[model samples]
Target: MQETHDINIIAWWGALLSTFLALVKLWELWNDRFRIDIGYNFTGAPDIGNEIFVRNLSSKPIILSYWELLYGSGKWPFRKLEEIESPGPDACDIRIDPHSSKTFTFAEENYFDWGLKTLKGRKIYMRLYVAGRRPVVKKLYG
Candidate 1:
């Protein structure tokens, strides 16, 4: 009888330890999932054409997969101003370290080629997406 009771107690302790270990592991995994910091600056319109520079200032590296530019206009339906192709493998993988910044030059010619006109004096919105993470959205009126 005593031996049986000892075995039961050992089994109970083992189950409890396993549960605790699993909880700790879950917490650690949740903590390391993903973290990001984003910053936006509206550089004045480009002199040569209607272009702007979007700067990313953050400590951790953010993998920007793609971005979209939209104009806020009141009408039957909102229109898409421009859709810039995300610089893929050829484009440098942006990794901004602490107190570091990266500049993305958006030119007007590219938009014109895509049948988009000047965005001057228009409210443009930018949406940036990173893989396996939430998108960082911003609105700029320049």
Candidate 2:
């Protein structure tokens, strides 16, 4: 009877430890899922032709400092980064609430500096810089 009791106690401890470990793993997985979704849409407007969307998937608000456009001119093995200059309300001031999204539009005139007629029909990508986190990158066009 004493041996059976000892075995039961050990089994109880084992089950408790397993539960604790599983809880820790669940917490890690929840934290790992903290991220944002960034994408773009071409509006085809004559003046402002592009709209970029940012969605915060985490429970906290996400502040975006700025975003860059990545593109390759030729067969070169490298791409270039062009910082987009938002017209008003500096990009850094943009905040996205948890489970919410925001859109940014750029005027057509901005493309002149990139030597492109328009942002459409070109190989382009976006990289959004977030405070206290790694920059989020996504393919925009091409």
Best-performing candidate as measured by TM-score: 2
Worst 10 residues of 1 by lDDT: 107-116
Q: What lDDT score goes with residue 5 in model 2?
A: 100
Model 1 misplaced regions, further than 4 Å: 39-62, 69-91, 97-125, 131-142
Runs of candidate 2 exceeding 4 Å displacement: 2-6, 9-17, 20-28, 73-77, 82-91, 108-122
**Clash pairs, model 2 backbone:** none
Evaluated at residue 102, the lDDT of candidate 2 is: 87
Q: How many residue pairs clash in each candidate?
A: 0, 0
Best by lDDT: 2
Residues 27-121, candidate 1: write the lDDT tens digits: 87776544443344433443333343444443345566666656644433664455443454465445544444455555554332212365545
Estimate the lDDT of model 1.
0.55
Provide the RMSD of all predictions against the true structure, rounded to 1 decimal.
7.6, 4.5
Give the Cα error of residue 38 in candidate 2, in Å: 1.7
**Model 2: per-residue Cα lDDT over 22-136, one tens digit each:** 9999998897576887776665563856677878888888888877766633334565545455344554457888999988766667642332564444556677778887887
